[model samples]
Target: MRKLIFMFFTVVLAVGVISAQDDLSGLTGKKAIKKANRAFNTFKLNQTNGGDDLKEARRVIDYVVKQDDTKEDPKTWVLMGDIYNGFSSFNQAQKVLNPDWENIEPNGGMVAFQAYKKALELEAGNKNALDGLSQIIGSISTAGLDAYEAGDYMGAFNSFRSILDIHDLLKENGAASPLDAEEEYDNQLYITGLAAMSAGQNATAKPFIQKLYDKQYDKPAVYDAMYKLTIDDDVDAAEDVLTKGREKYPDDLGLLFSEINHYLKLEKIEILEEKLKFAIEKEPENPSLYSTLGNVYDKLYQTNYKEGKTEEADKYFNLSKKYYEDAIKIKPDYTDAIYSVGALYYNKAAIVTEEMNALASDYSKEGTEKYNMKKAEVESLFSEALPYFKKVEKLDPNDRNTLIALKEIFARNNDFDTSNEFKMRLEKVESGETIEKSYFQ
Candidate 1:
């Protein structure tokens, strides 16, 4: 009698387990769906605790997705994408034993892509799907870049081509397209251009690059590529391209600066000066404007000095000084301007000293009397230059260049005491001692 009871209990337990499995197998109806969704949510939360629970979460998501009744629901497709994305993220953190692994599958991205694609397929003007697809495409593009950097050119190309495919698909379906369809199409042209350029096929690259330039006129890289084409012997062509760029981006200071530099190279000083003046007027606060103006003045000084126009050269030098000072005032940390001003002062002192020496030697009879006056003027000019040199030294005490200049100046003037003091200070500076400021009163 006891053995018979045990057999009957076993049979009942097996039937109960079978019935429970059937209930979980293919849930149907609204109430069943709500239960499946609740199960999915509970599994998703459990997955966050990691460890063994992640596998349980995946099983729940898979089971929910496998339900034939819910397969057609768009939300189910989206949930599938989310699950796949979760797996991918987990795979990315593979080093972690308890990683969220559901995100690794490309199908997840594709599922999201297709979900939106299908949504749009159903309702042609669905903005939500369009936006979601755009996002998925962008995500795919980033993934492609990563693959490319890992030497997966085929992967990169495939990723980029996917975007183009989507564009074509949108066009074919009469769905809304990007604002610049032609330009969008031209991206393929740019990729080809980059490939050709990499292979040194300049001629082949030219047309593609030119088309891109025509579309995006103000892109520096486009100008740069065109500029490289003419760098050897086509200065005129280069100038023409730059002129076009200037016309397109008139307010671009870099373009204006480059134009001025080109004019300077071509020896068109008047035009260069006009451009510089215009830039100054437009951006007076730009320290570069003053620095460039200083450069122009320095160039003028060089020309006048070479032509033996002492007075004209002196005037230009003073103008250079003013411009450089303006630059420093605008940006106190402008080391180049500071250095230029210091060098200019030294040059002025040298010229004045030369004048005094000539006057003293040529007029010996009127010497001592006239010599004292002229020597004093020379000394004053040298004194003016001294402060600037000292400033350079203080700013960069270990600057061998500034030290050499100071040494030469003092040696020439027979101020050995002062020169020796500067040399010691420089040594101390180089040894890591902090130097204090030495200002002129």
Candidate 2:
């Protein structure tokens, strides 16, 4: 009797399991949608109201979505989209609690977007799908913002990209999108490119950034960004953008600086000189142009000197000095030009000292005479730098680079106390502490 009772219980449990598994498959047409609607309603009421509601919704919708009668129904697609969207919500909520909820389903946003898009494609007047698409777009935009604020740049890029795709899909379906087509396209493309670049997706960023450039966005930073991306792979392409930017934004310092950087990277000193000269011709009174030219000549001097071309190096050094003096003559209070002149003297003196030290020791009589003569020249150069650096200190009292330069100059001259004072101020500046204002005075 006990064996017979156990056999009866086992048969009943097996029948129950089959019944539960075949429940949704057994229904068709309206009956299937009715069951799905109930499960969806349960899901909507409380997303975490056990996973059964969403699971049943998915089961019923999956079955109905493939059936002949319901396959083309807009309502069926909407239901499917809603169910998957619920899955996304559930996974996100669960992840907060467990932090290990591995998402194995299709991306909820994309699935929902495509499903609702199809529903709308079938019937533009499908209010449910339209509303769902709008909500999805909002959700995607919000997700992008949240990711960006959290510094998850790739996540932000993906979310923004989806928002763009959904809006495009809506437009393709003859439905009016909530966003302004032109303005939103430009804004979205810019942000998407920026986020992609920030996430180190250089290839992905190129098209979007190029789109902005093609539209003549008139933003200097955009040119800078595009050039930076193309510089390593296609330098000619980078130069083209820089040239266009210079033409459009004649006074934009960023583009000017980027052009300078490009030439410096290529080590095309002569081209750089010509470019700077042309720029100065365009804006003759712009002191910054001369100062920039001076810096380029300084670089050329170093390069030529390194290559054993002493005459070329001396020629470049004279040109650099001439440009700096021109800049100063045009604007006496031009702090940058003033600093460049000081830097030029200090750098030249450093080179001379290095060469002399390499040749002889100061202990020998002949070496002593040579050392004293070279030392006098070096001290004279520092003396020339002194007044400019002092002037710079007065012009921009809190400038850290100037403070460092002053410290080095004073130390080179063996004025230890003044050098130590500047050193203290420099350390305070570097550490973000306040230095005594009277010290600069």
Candidate 3:
């Protein structure tokens, strides 16, 4: 009886060990899903660290996936894709353990892409899978662009071709299919055009931009991009693009401004002047158009100044002042134009003062009269500049540059008391101390 009892106990012990082994091997359904989730979280957190912890996370995911519970679980397939999409040393452990990983490309992105593709195949409407796939493809295309910019033609070609594949994928899927269809489409076209441009295939880029234009005719940003692509090689082509864009978007400030800029670049001053005059006629109250005209005058003045045409430079400088004043009249808060006016007067004053100083050093008696006249002219110019600078100070007292300029101007005229007052005000403003309202009044 004792021998039989001992044998029975041994048999029970063996059965218990076998049951435990089966539990580890046969994880399925909900249990497998639960394990996968736990592993996924662990993998995500450890992805940035990249070492043994990552390896352990992959082990957990692999154990669950190998259970072969059900191929119908789209969630499982998606999770698998996520693991592959974010694959690092931890995510690729199973493949590494196998011989195939050795032959896989060194780029982690390509491997991640394959996994995402598989997930998309299992679930066509899977948003996460599609996004992952798009990102991977976009990254690959961007890498190509970097290579091309570095003068690596072959590398750029490969990267651009990968981008083309992504474009094809997006085309096959309708715009409504992706979470961000507009963004995806825009990105795809941009990448396509950029690659073609880098490859010196401007003609190829043209169609991509045209497609984007067709999708959103009023998009000024697209028009600007397309204009840049076509302008250098073909002016007439660029003009046609602008004309069509203008026809569709007559009121687009960006398109109109771009057209004006193009004419200016081609030195078609008459055409540019006509366009600006017409724009001003249409929008008489528009401060920006006046500002643009001021810029043109400023540019002309600079060109003439460099060429030693003093009279012509003065004429354009006066024209610049007139336009800037017009801009300020249209919108009193036009700070940029106000600043420009102040800068013009300040520059004029500096020139006169410099000339006077030079004369005084050479011919003392005659120079005294000239110097006095020049000093009077300088004072007149400063009178014009003072209101604008004061306006700037009022608007932004914290602007140290403007405050310093005010103090220097006051001190230069031997107004020591006023100069000290401005200096004190500056210090008070910087320290967030209050000033008496009576002082300004």
Clashes of each: 11, 0, 0
Q: Compared with the true structure, what per-residue lDDT tens digits does model 1 show for residues 1-441?
A: 999999999999789545434535544533444544554565456654442333333444556655666655655545544444444444445536643434345444545565556555556656555655555665655555655676666555556556666666666666655523665567655654554555566776677678877777446656656655555568888888888778777877777777887887777765876898899988889887888788788888878987899899989888888998999899986767777787776776666667677776665667766767767876676667666666766666666667766876787689898778667766776778865654221
lDDT of 3 at 341: 83
lDDT by residue for model 3 (1-441), tens: 999999999999789545423444656655755655665676566545443333343444555555666455556655665554454333245454654544123344555565555566666756776666666664465456556777765566656555555455545554222324567657666656656666777776778777887677446657776887878878998898888888777888778888888887877755776688778877799998887787678777767876889999899899889999999998987777887788778877877778777777756677688888888998999878888877876766556656666787888878989879789878987888865442334
What TM-score does structure 3 among the candidates reach?
Answer: 0.50
Residue 51, model 3: lDDT of: 36
In terms of lDDT, the poorest run of 10 residues in model 2 is 17-26
lDDT of 2 by residue, 63-90 (tens): 8888888889898899888887777677
The local distance difference test score of model 2 is 0.81
Q: Could you estimate the TM-score for every candidate?
A: 0.56, 0.55, 0.50
TM-score of 1: 0.56
Candidate 1 wrong stretches, greater than 4 Å = 1-136, 142-180, 183-209, 215-233, 263-268, 352-378, 421-441
Task: Give the local distance difference test score of model 3.
Answer: 0.67
